[model samples]
Target: MKKIFVLDTNVLLQDPNAIYAFEDNEVVIPAIVLEEIDNKKRNADELGRNARQISRMMDGLRNQGRLFEGIDLPNGGRLKVELNHRSFAKLQETFAEGTNDNRILAVALNYHMEEQENPNPRPVVMVSKDTLVRIKADVLGLTAQDYLTDRIVNMPDMYMGYLTIHAHPSVIDEFYTYRYLNVNSLHLAYPLNPHEFVILKDEMGTSKSALLKVNADGKKLEPLFLSNDPIWGIGARNAQQRMALELLLNDEIPIVTLTGKAGTGKTLLTLAAGLLKVEDERKYKKLLIARPVVPMGKDIGYLPGEKEEKLRPWMQPIYDNLEYLFDTKKAGDIEKILAGLGSIQVEALTYIRGRSIPGQFIIIDEAQNLSKHEVKTIVSRVGEGSKIVLLGDPEQIDHPYLDASSNGLTYVVERFKAQNISGHITLERGERSHLAQLAADLL
Candidate 1:
């Protein structure tokens, strides 16, 4: 049986193309959702962009027929703008508020009631990205679900970019002697992806092990390009970080993703590799660092200054890492170093849109705050001869509509894991400090 889907404002804001995702199922857009989208259509952010895009889509649909009655979608689904279900009569007793959420719930509840009156009723699902909305829907005895089109389902067991295999003791020795081993020699149960990291352990249970990477051909295991060499004075402290560096420094792999908790050295390692490639090796003409400007807690509101000064707080973390890499002795020293280098640019992700970036090493910090579309827009802006590294902890996202499973960082990690030009590593250990590591684990 065909179902009916009621979309909340956030679902459309997170993904403008969600209207077409229901797949021949009737999609209902409450009138309140249009109002909310209109309110957000003018502001300059991802939400505003999505709101405008959705408006344009609705406009295009409007030309075909009256939305209030119902319009046939290209995918054989029916789209309708519901304007009559705004009354809170059904929810006044329990909800007791005329808020937008309650209004949306009212619309879904009305559809549910109408379906019940029919001899054969279709399932009514309220799709939203908000947890409270889903809970309230359940309280109202309405079926609800998350917008899962872009969500990575098995997030807990998602790809970690590496695997451990126990082989014959001689396999480890052979890898060391030959410097490379064919995939068939491992007698593996699963196929290894290109550039996937491997830890070959001794089957006899000795302390012998070797770290290797699947070559681009995905047919051989090869030793790391930089075993112990430090990049820009920063060395990998763990096996995962070592694997990350292997991908970060490789020119053939143009996209690298690093994910970890608060202090797993994701940003530090990425910055180190970017600096080396842009400065020491001169492989790239510039080092461009950008990150979404999502606030962590209560926002500090606006500050008074020019663009650079206004962006100082948001870019301070990047500066701190650069300060460490440059070993700046005093305040403002890193800024001077950046100025003298003349090849490094640090800006918000906002300014990066619509520009074709080439011959640069780009590092997108806190990438987990970005939505799938936002990340796609930024990455698609990469021109030839450019490499983009996205680094963030999926669990530490700050975007209101994004979660660990749906955020762009995890999304890219899963989508690009099998591609030859992309590589990913999830750092498990925190190397910031003993206290930081303990705090990350315990609290």
Candidate 2:
């Protein structure tokens, strides 16, 4: 049966080509959605770019006929700008003054109810990016769905890029004794992502032991060099950890991005790699680490004391990682290291703008908090002979305008992965305490 898809403004803002995504399904653009798009089109960001793209698409369609009325889309569905629907009557009982969401709902309700009365009726599905709007659709008894095309992956299943395998007891022995196993031979359930972790279980025994990682190939993976352990003194806990270490240790791929849950070692690996490159390989002259001060916005509110003092809290985790790396036993040991090393600098991302960095090993933590535009700006600042790593999990992102799929970190990974100079790995499994892993999974 033919179906009608009513798109929300946010869906278009998130991805302008959303209209073409419905394939053969009829597309109904609520009149209010245009107004919302018009309001956001002037902004200078990804959303604005998408809005303009949508405008251009609508313009291109204008040649076929008036898009405001009805036009045939390339996907074999009719594109329409809905101006009237009888469902507005239902809104009168629920909302005295109609809000935009209510109006969009009214359009879907009108269509659904009218179709129900039709001898031959079609399905009407409301497509939106807002969770609340979808919830309201259920209350109104209309079908609702997220515009899933913009998502980086299909589901939470993308967490570690997933791979499961069973190995003879020998693989576990190789993992503990060799501390690394061949990349092949494990025969992962899923194709191995460069830094993807795997849990190798004893296929036969219920009480059999587990091997955290045995590498993707049957080659001896790099051992955890004591020098490369996170400042916290912990190493990669599983196969994914070793994979992450391999990617981090290699100097050829100048840009690497790591995305994983907290304790999956995203930050730890980046820091460890940066330290290894700077202190051991001399691949770069300095190791510079920085993170966005803003969790959601660019705002850094005024704080007491000096600039560094105000930044201390935002940079605390970075310091903690550094402290662990240095094995600072005394209370002030880390501060002293920071004073002497001078090679390592922890600062806010705000200061990074307009600075041309060269011959440095740079690690940008919490990169998911950065906007696509902001990321472009930061990456462009790199001069020749520099390696910059951007690390963060999209699911754990705090950026208001970006989701896991569209955030700067994911954006960078997708955009750069094809290039020989760049690589990406999504870490799975938490090396943190079992409780932390449980929280990541359930909560």
Candidate 3:
């Protein structure tokens, strides 16, 4: 049976196309929902963009029929603004001001009670992204649910950028003797993304381990067993760091996303690989890096100095990576190399809004702070033959509207995992220092 769903303001703010996503089911928009959308329509963040999108969608639907009563949707569902709800009971007794939330709850209550009075009652469900709203619905004896259209993964299944694989009985023998194995030797499950990491164990599922990368067909691609120690200089303190280098070094996979705790080598490895590709290999034309300049919990006011000094705090990490890559002898020598390269440019993501970048290596750090709309804007700016790497940990996100699962990093992982042009990895190791990894794990 077709059910009726009452949408909350947070639902629309979280995802603009949520209304149409509940296809073939009747979707009800509370009268108070419009007031909430109107209040958020002026802001510049993700919520404001979604509110504006919902407004435009509603306006376009006016051509079909009356929204106040009801209108037929393209996907075979009906939408209308609830008019029979007055919220006198919920407001006079529970809340004093008849807030939009209380008004929405009142609509759900009215619908549920109406269904109860019918001979063949259809289910009335209230959908929201607010935990408080769901709790309030429970208090009022109503069924509530989370609007989950935008979540890329649950907490457990989110890409940590690495995974351990127990090798077969002869896998270790093959790696030790041959130093490399064909893609068919490893019997991995189907549908593995290109450049994803895997650990080859000693058949016993423990002992004498080796890290490898998967080709497009889930084959053992990288077997960097060059008779010795790991890449100590680049800092693979954890197994995931070893995995990160496998992705960073491979040129076949154009796109990669690295998410990890603080002090991880996410920025360092990407910048290092980018330098190798542009300067040494001449594989790409330029090395471009950009990030949102959102300050730590506040705005960065004007700084009275040169451009480098003005952007010091926001771009400090990027500068540090350049300094390391150049092996600068003097204090200000890194900047000289940057000027000499001429191909390396650090611009704000805002400036990339209108330009088309091709045949370059682009890295967007602190990407977890971006909204779905903002990330879309940045990714669409990529032209032909360019590799755009998005690196950021959603756990360290600073955006108010984004969480671990709702941010653009996870969104991209969920949306593009199946495509051939994109690839992703979640760096689990903190290669900064022993203390850094300890703090990330225990503290």
Candidate 1 structure, TM-score to reference: 0.93
Best by TM-score: 1
Which should have the higher lDDT, number 1 or number 3?
Answer: 1
**Model 1, C-alpha of 36: deviation from truth (Å):** 1.2
RMSD of each: 2.6, 5.1, 3.8
Best by lDDT: 1
TM-scores for all candidates?
0.93, 0.74, 0.83
Q: For residues 79-159, what per-residue lDDT tens digits would candidate 2 score against the true structure?
A: 998876655778678665688888988898898888999999899999998889899888888999988776665445444
Backbone clash count for every predicted candidate, in the order shown? 0, 14, 2
Per-residue alpha-carbon lDDT of candidate 1 for residues 137-242, written as tens digits (9 for 90 to 100): 9999999999989677467788999999999999999998999999999887789999999999998989999999999889999998876788788998989988
What shift in Å separates residue 154 of candidate 1 from its native position after superposition? 2.5
Query: What's the lDDT for candidate 2?
Result: 0.75
Error of 3 at 431 (Å): 2.6
Clashes of 1: 0
